[model samples]
Target: MSAETIVKKCVFVEAINLICILMAKCSRLCRGNIYSLLKMSKGSSSRERG
Candidate 1:
């Protein structure tokens, strides 16, 4: 293999790793928001029923 090809492969791998990291962070954030929303809804419903 050539040095150029090796560099390209390294870059591609780095890009994929960066994308995966970003996706993981975004999913965690979304999950937290959804969890909080669910908790709020439950609390409101319970208050109404009581």
Candidate 2:
């Protein structure tokens, strides 16, 4: 009910929000990296067979 408590709660909520956003971004980046690597290897293998 105090002003200090309200401010602390706001800061905690903001931190949690930021953490969630960063995690989502990191997972998307990781997925892109894995997809690209798989594509490159597949291309190389096909070239070798040809």
Candidate 3:
């Protein structure tokens, strides 16, 4: 793919990483998915802000 697509994918993966980190200490299964969703939203918004 192109650089832009790569960057976007990186953002997504970064968000996933952050979510995983946040859920690392939590035992609830739902928290991990919720954090992933939150991270996706945050990543998109942060790109706009940037």
Report the Cα RMSD per candidate.
Answer: 2.0, 2.7, 17.8
Residue-wise C-alpha lDDT for candidate 2, range 1-50, written one tens digit per residue: 99999999999999999999999999999999999999999999999999
Q: What local lDDT does model 3 show for residue 41? A: 96
Candidate closest to the true structure, highest lDDT: 1
**Each model's TM-score?**
0.67, 0.61, 0.48
Tell me the deviation in Å of residue 46 in model 1. Answer: 6.7
Between which residue pairs do clashes occur in model 1? none
As a whole number from 0 to 100, the lDDT of residue 6 in candidate 1 is 100
Candidate 1: tens digits of C-alpha lDDT, residues 1-50: 99999999999999999999999999999999999999999999999999
lDDT for each candidate structure: 0.99, 0.98, 0.90
The number of residue pairs in model 2 that clash at the backbone is 0
Reference-based TM-score, model 3: 0.48
Clashing pairs in 3: none
List candidate 1 stretches off by more than 4 Å. 41-50
Clashes of each: 0, 0, 0
